[model samples]
Target: MARPNLTRPNATRPDAAGPNAAGPNVHRVQPGASVQAAVDAAHPGDVVELAAGNYPGSVTIATDGVTLRGQGNRSVLVPDPADHSACAAAGNGLCVTGVADDRGMPVRPVSGAVVESLAVAGFAKNGIAAAVTDKLTVHQVASHDNGLQGISVEMSTRTVLTENEARDNGQAGIFVANWFDRKGGALETRGTQVAANRLTGNRIGLQLRRVRDLTATGNLASGNCGGIFVVGDDGVPRAGSLSIANNVVRANNRYCEPNPRLDSVQGTGILLTGTEDVVVSENLITDHSGTSPMSGGIVLYPSVVGAPNARAVVTDNILADNLPVDLADLDQRNGSSFMTNSCRTSQPAGHC
Candidate 1:
């Protein structure tokens, strides 16, 4: 399927007055009120405007074209242990779920759902989680201190996650995956974008796993165990066809213990594994120094499942002060090349 235009119109702004503004179509909820009730009662193209206060409990959005807007970061959403809503029960602060198959793959994605200008923190799982949603826009939200991901999108396409602040999360600040619990071939994201976000103090700043046809650009990632990770596996269709460009990734030197899926990670910047046809260009990766095997600038390692990267293009990046080497092509897969990168050192001796 062709990708939809991900831009939002001015009329969709929180202050905009339209047929759905400040009336029956717009549902305003105060701090103690139920956000879920307004969400449930909303029709398509309606706005659920939240007042500037702390809202407890979790809410779920299943309806299409619903805009959940808040008064900037002053509107905060926190966990309510006593609230047994499905979103809270699942340990997510806010969830947008759509029709899925028995295997948990999206069959019919929720369309035109927006979540913006709010803060969500201290959730056991993700701050904001979306599964099987298309053209889902999450912007200007502050997601921090979540147990899992700050913002997670899975089995979805055409997602726009821009201008968000994600920090101090246990896992990736922003995570995009085909499926979290299952193994499969890479899904085609059809122009999903992760752009212009500030990410710090997470295990990994950003992670793109088992997905293709995506772009991650103009972001700042620092102070994490790893800056960015593009991971694929032995699954068919293999993750690739993506662009990682024009980003600043630096000083990801925090030490994170080995998890069930990965070894101890620290001081890594832009690690790409088991992917094909990926472009890593115009990024400033610097000041990452650690003893871990994965530590370096633009390191390409084999995937966890031992699949090697192929046909990757590493070009036009400014790399400096990375430990072990600036560019380490540990995979040395076929048809991969490094050219025109301004870096001091590399494992193979002459790629720089």
Candidate 2:
């Protein structure tokens, strides 16, 4: 889809020298100014061009419609270089602290926002968080080395997250949670797209929970606890759909003793529990090795955290070298089919 070239009320677009053509209302964020201050000064359709510098603070954005494009992805929203020692001391000091886990004030709510071309690191928590918002687009951003997820979208609809890099997070790289308390308690997630991103060195590359009608395509996931984990909460998973294609999942270490226990180090390349009617197809899954017998290329079981035994579909995936097993722990109540999967040296023809 083509984006408009309009400027936000107070925000400015980049100039001739920057990545995108200079829009009329672009603003330049200097070294000393606070990130919050720059956000405050920005209006809808504005672009905040950040120069290379160390900014020590968090920013909360309330603008409903705007574009925040950084000068360059890597140099723009990086951690404060001055705080390197403190960051190392603090452990995983990248961007804002507590961006996920129902904490922190959001720079941009999950609704009606657009953020692109920014490098966000050292967040004590998530690099970017979206909750209960709609029609948000996050593109060309780099989120890494945070305490929690690189980016989290919770209870939002019609959101597009594309061409982003989520890596080295202490927890899951990207988590899409669509659980919200509406009138009389209901859950809904419509049309969420996660595409063309690189996720590596996290607990889980992408976690989808309590939502459906989603698409995850053209992504690369490696060196994490799990490549992709889809789960439901409390009860049987609803009748929703998830499509994953053209992605690479590999080398997920189940026992990442560095953080320990906070994540499921003994996890799977793709785990489906209490999640039904999902699809895993045309993806490359390889080199999944862990100490536990339950760890496999794809794992389907009841929940260790919540309820269990849901239906799912696992088909047409290249499963190779998944150590200990290829597929394991199918729930007795689970309703699914595993067909056309290429297993490597596993028993029962892909059954563990």
RMSD of candidates 1 onward, in order: 3.9, 5.9
lDDT of 1 at 19: 41
lDDT string for model 2 (52-114, tens) is 665554545556554566655644454554544433344332222212244322334434667
Give the lowest summed-lDDT range of ten residues in model 1.
Answer: 1-10
lDDT of 1: 0.90
Candidate 1, 77-109: lDDT as tens digits: 999989998889989999999999898877889
Poorly placed runs, candidate 2 (over 4 Å) = 6-24, 78-110, 179-186, 236-240, 257-263, 345-352
TM-scores of all models? 0.94, 0.79
Cα deviation in Å at residue 335, candidate 2? Answer: 2.3
Lowest summed lDDT across 10 adjacent residues in model 2 is found at 179-188
List candidate 1 stretches off by more than 4 Å. Answer: 1-24
The TM-score of candidate 1 is: 0.94
